[model samples]
Target: MRILVTGGAGFIGSALVRRLIAHTDHEVLVYDKLTYAGVLSSLEPVASSNRYSFVQADVCDAEAVAKALREFKPDVVAHLAAESHVDRSIDGPGEFIQTNMVGTFVMLNQALGYWRGLDEAAKARFRFHHISTDEVFGSLGEEGFFTETTPYDPRSPYSASKAGSDHLVRAWGHTYGLPVLVTNCSNNYGPYHFPEKLIPLIIIRALNGEPLPVYGDGSNVRDWLFVDDHARALQAVFETGTPGETYNVGGNAERKNIEVVTAICSILDRLRPKAEGKYADQITYVTDRPGHDHRYAIDASKIRADLGWTPSVTFEEGIERTVVWYLENQAWWQAILDARYATQRLGVA
Candidate 1:
C-alpha cells in the first residue's frame, strides 16, 4: 500500500516512516510542516529509498493537503501531525488548538473529498487513521485502566485539542460514512525523540553534568510505549483495523516520573559512569505544571485481542536502548541543541 504519513518528520511519525520503508513493502510519502519539533534528519535512514518521499507542508493548509492527496494517491492517510508537548501546551495553547484541532478538521475534509472521488475498491481500501494520546482520557486514580469506552476528560491544552480531534474523526466516520480509524496510545519514548521530553531530557542533561529536573513530587505515573513498538501498532491498526473503531495501544509498563528519571540515571551510570558520584545525585524537584495529570494507563487488551499487536520492548530494555542511542549519536541531538532548544524548562503557567 502507498501511505501518506502526516508529521512523518517528528518523533513517532519518523519512526513509523522508517518502519514502513525498512520492514514493509509499502511506499511512503511524508507530509510535514517542519515545526520546531519536526527534524528532517530523523528520516535519514529511509530518505534514499525510491519508495520513500517527502513533502514539506502544513496540514492546516487545505490546498497543500489536497495537492498531496491528489498526487500521492495514498491508500492510507495516517494523521500524526500535532503540537504534542504537554508543558509547551501549558505555556502556549493557541498553537495546540490550531494545529491539533483545526489541522485535523482540514485533513478530514480533504480526505473525505478524496475518498469520494475514488472508485468503490479504492474507497474501500482507503483509511484515515487518527493517532492520539491516552491523555485524552485525563488522569486515572491508581487501579483502573483507560479502555476504549473511557470518557474523555482532557485536562491540559494538548490533550483537550487532541480530544477534539478524535471526536472530529469519529464524527466524519459516523456522519459522512468515511472510513476512519482512531488509536489512542500511551507515552512514547525511544530513538530520535525530541530532547524536550522526559527520557531524552534526563539523558541529555545527565550527560552534560546538569541537573535533571523532576516536576512536583515526581510521582506522576505514565505508561511508557517504545516508539518502534508504537510504529508497529500503527501498522497493525491501519492495515487491518475496523473503520470507525478505536484502539488503545500501550507498553504495559507503568512507572512513576521519579522512577523513569532514576532508571535513566542507572543506565547512564552503568554505560557512562561519572568519575565520583551517581547520575541520580543531580536529580532535583521543581514546581509542577498547571493541570498536571496524576496518572495515565491504557487497557490494550482490545488491540492485542483484535489485531494481535503488543509492545515488543519492556521499559528496562527500551530505556537502555534509548540511552545507548543518545550516547552513540551525540551529533544527532547536539545539532538539535545547537540549532533549537537547549533542554530548558517550559510550561511554567
Candidate 2:
C-alpha cells in the first residue's frame, strides 16, 4: 500500500513515517511544509529507503495537494499538518486557523475529488485519516475522561482549529461519502520531539541548567501517550477502521504538571547528574496561558476493546527513553537551538 502523510517531518508524524518505512511493506511519501517544528532531520533515519519519499509542500495549497495526490496515487492519506503549539496559538491564532481549519478544508476537498476519480475498487480501499487532539474536549474536572462522544469545548485557538478540522472530515464523510477516519489522541512524547511542548521543553531546559517553567500552581494534568504507540494505532485505524468513525487513543498514564517535571528531574539526576543540585531545583512558576485546560484524559476503552490496541510502554519507561534520546542526540536538538529557530520560529516568543 502507498500512504501519504502530511506533516510527516514533525514529531509524531515523523515517528509514524519511520514506523511505516521500518516495520511495514507500505510505501510512504511525506508531505510537509517544513515549518519550524517540522525538522527534516527527524526523518533522516528512513529517508534512504526505497519505499520512503518526501515532498515539501503546504497543505493549504490546493494545486500542490492535488498534484501530489495524482502523482502518488496513495491508498491512504494521513493528515497531521497543523500549527500545534498551544502557547504559540495563544500568542498568534491566525496561523492556527489558517493551517488547521483552512488547510484541512483544502485537503478534504482535494481528497474527495481524488477519491471520486478513483476506480471503484480503489475508491473502496482509500482512507483519509485526520489526526486530532484530546484538548478539543476541553478541561476535565476532577472526574471523567474524554470519550469519542464527548462534547467539544475548545478553550484555545489550537484546539478550536483542530475541532473545526475534525468536523470537516466527518462532514465530508457524511455529506460527500468520503471514507474518513478521525482520532483524538492524548499528548505524545518521544524522540525527535521539538522542544516547545511540555516534555521536550522541560528536558531541554533541565539539560541547560535553566529554569523549568511550570504554569500556574503546576497542578494541570495530561494523559501522555508514547508517539510510537500512537503511530501504530494510527496505522490500525486507517487500515481497518469504519468510515466516519472517531477513536480516542491514549496511554492510560496520567500525571500532573509538577509531577512530570519532578519525574524528569529524577531521571536526569541519575543519567546526567549536575554538580550544583537536582534539576527540580530550577522549577519556577509562571503565569498560566489564557484558557489553559486544567486536565485532559482519554477513555481509550473503545479502541482497546474494538481494535485490540494498547500502549506498550509505561510512562516511566517512555520518559526514561525520551531523556536518554535527548541526552545522546544533543547534535539533533542543539542544532535547532543554535539556529535560533527554537526561540524565533513559529512565533514562539
Candidate 3:
C-alpha cells in the first residue's frame, strides 16, 4: 500500500513510519513541517529505504497537502501531525489551534476531495486514520478509565484542538462518506521520543544529575503504552477497523507520576549509578500545571477484543528498555538536546 503519514518526523509519527518501513511492504511518505520538536534526525533510520520518502511542508498548507495527496495517490492517509506538548500549548495556544484544528480541517477536506476522485476499488480500500490522545477525556478522579465512548472534556489547548480534529474526522465520515478511523491512545514511551515529553525528559535529567521536576504532589496517574505496541495497534485499526468508529489503545500499565519517576531512578541507579546518590535524590516539585488532569487511563478493551491486540510489555520492562535505549543511543537523543531544542521547561511562561 502507498501510505502518506503527516507529522512523520514527530515522536509517534516517526516511530510509526519506522515500523512501516522496516516490517511492512507498504510505501510510506512522511509529510512534516519540521517544527522544533519535529526532528528529521528521528526519521534517519528509514532514510535509505526505497519504500520511504519525505516532504517538508505544513499540514495547514492546503495546496501542498493536496498536491502531495494527488501525486502520491496514497491508499491510506495516517494523520499524526499536530502541536502535542500540553505545556507548550499552555504557553502558546495559537500554534496548537493552527496546527491541530486548522491543519486537520485542511487535510480532511483535501483527503475527501482526493478520495472522491479515486477509482471505485481504490475508494473502497482508502482510509483516513486520525491518531488522538486520551487526555481529551479530561482528568479522571479516583476510578474509571477512558473508553471509546467517554465524553470529551478537554482542559488544555492541546487536547481541545485534538478533540476538534477527532470530531472533524468523524463528521467527515458521517456527512461525506470519508473512510475515517480514530484512535485515542495512552502515554507512549520508547526510543526516538523527543525529550520535551515526560519519559525522555526524566531520563536525561537523571543522567546529568539535574533535578527531576514532578508536577503537583506527583499522585497524578497515567496509563503508559509503549510506542511499538501503539504502532502495531494503529496498523490493525487502519487495515480492518470500521470507518467512523473510535478505538482506545493502551498498555494497561497504570502508574502514578511519582512512581514513574522513582522507577526511572531505580533503573538508572542500578544500570548507570552516580557516585553521589540515587537518581531519586533530584526530585523537586513545583507549581502544578494549569488544569492538569488527575489521571488518564485508557479502556482499550474494544481494540483488544475487536482486533485481537494488547500491549506485550510490562511498564517495568518498557522503562528498562527505554533507559537502555537512551544509554546506548546518546547520539540520537543528545543531538536533539544540544540542537536548538532543549528539554527546558516548556509552557511555563
TM-score of each: 0.97, 0.98, 0.97
lDDT for 133 (candidate 2) = 97
lDDT of each: 0.96, 0.94, 0.92
Model 2 has an lDDT value of 0.94
Q: For residue 240, what is the lDDT in candidate 3?
A: 86
| TM-score quality measure for candidate 1 | 0.97
Q: Write the per-residue lDDT of candidate 1 for residues 220-311, one digit (tens) a residue.
A: 99999999999999999999999999999999999999999999999999999999999999999998878889999999999999999989
> What is the lDDT, from 0 to 100, of the residue 25 in candidate 1?
95
Poorly placed runs, candidate 1 (over 4 Å): 341-349
The lDDT-based order of candidates, best leading, equals 1, 2, 3
lDDT of 2 by residue, 95-165 (tens): 99999999999999999999999999999999999999999999999899999999999999999999999
Candidate 3: C-alpha lDDT? 0.92
Pairs that clash in candidate 1: none
**What C-alpha RMSD separates each model from the true structure?**
2.4, 1.6, 2.3
Off by over 4 Å in 2: 341-349
Best by lDDT: 1
